[model samples]
Target: MIFLIYGTDKDKSHEFLERLMARFLKGKNFFSLHRLDEESFSESVFNGLLKTDSLFLNKNLVVAKRLFQNFAAADYILSNLEILGSSGNVFVFWEEKIKDDFLKKIKKYAEVKKFDSAARPDFKKKKEDEELFKVADLVALRKKQEAWFLYQRIIMKGGPCEEVFWKILWQMKVLGLIKRGGGRKLHPFVLAKAKRAAGLFQEKELDGFLGELVQIYHDYRNGTADLAVGLERFILRV
Candidate 1:
């Protein structure tokens, strides 16, 4: 049984992992709980612990953290997801962030949960972002001037930089999906808008733009860049 709790909401994910461990330990006298981390991860140790239980405990739970950021551990996990899934012990992987491709493969082998920090805007964001979706629509209509104006208006009225940034990124993702003709899962109105926006950029351009948007958020989180400034620059560049 493999369980993967990941994404940008580290606090929530960590709390959830602890709650789950508590539930698993309820009414239990002796249980084996093993932990692995980026600096301490070892394939040999992980494998040994997975198959070996203490004499005093009948069930074992192995909780791993941020191993995906470690190249060796990541590669080992990618190659052994199936084995981990079928193992007798419960395997829990707690990650702050993981690459999309790696996450996709892990989804097939584990009970997965993703907690995004951006899902809830900060109180400083207020309700000014109510019209933020309009920015995406403006882009689809190729009204760069109006898009920039609306974004500026929202930001001036307490709209969060993270919210606006994610909105623009979402627009790019939708456009990219429509460009690739793979937005069958999107809402009809959104799909229509994306079709209009898809013409504004080539596939490679959208990919590059998306990558840069992700980097901007990462840099902002790491305190290396201001999200508002980065978003302003990106919107101007696009």
Candidate 2:
């Protein structure tokens, strides 16, 4: 069986993958396992590996990290997925991010699992925290309309405006650190999400957003601007 493991939680996704491989190899008499990363992988290499006969091994496992990010590799794998299955190799595709349409298509042939960053235990403890992440993620993904809608919902639920504001700021800070070549101390999951989201805005844009947010907070405190309206406008402008 092929396993397509992806999403924001890189550490857990890799842990799960290792556990799966261990489970598969536990009682095996002979097993063949291979690993490849994006830089070391290509359609030709994968095809040759698939077609090669493993006479001594009863099971085969090929772990590829971010292989689908390459168009040729993705196309080859999608087209020949059934062939891979028939060849008796358990292929694992691990990625931090992937195209939504490709993920949907792979579900038919692969056991797909997504480990969302917001679904962690800490965020699960408070419903509002989960909602806050939704807003933060939407903004990071540049889904401004959805971010504004979720922000409004959080406000209606009496969630602290400052809490949401700080979370967004924190998310931006993480992204800024990534863009500026820092954040080595962050959790693997947080680092991965920040790297993925950093593409949405340039360093100058992030700095501008933070400055605007500071002014908005000042205006709110002085009673010159409605916090909710100011925040909503900020989300749209991002």
After superposing candidate 1, which stretches have Cα over 4 Å from the reference? 53-57, 119-238
Model 2 pairs in collision: none
* RMSD of candidates 1 onward, in order: 12.7, 16.3
Report lDDT (Cα) of residue 232, candidate 1. Answer: 76
Query: TM-scores for all candidates?
Result: 0.49, 0.48
Cα deviation of 175, candidate 1, in Å = 49
Q: Which candidate number has the best TM-score? A: 1
TM-score quality measure for candidate 2: 0.48
For model 2, how does the per-residue alpha-carbon lDDT over 141-227 read when each residue is reduced to its tens digit? Answer: 889999998898887855667678878888877888888999999999988888899987899999888889889877754435766
Off by over 4 Å in 2: 53-58, 119-238
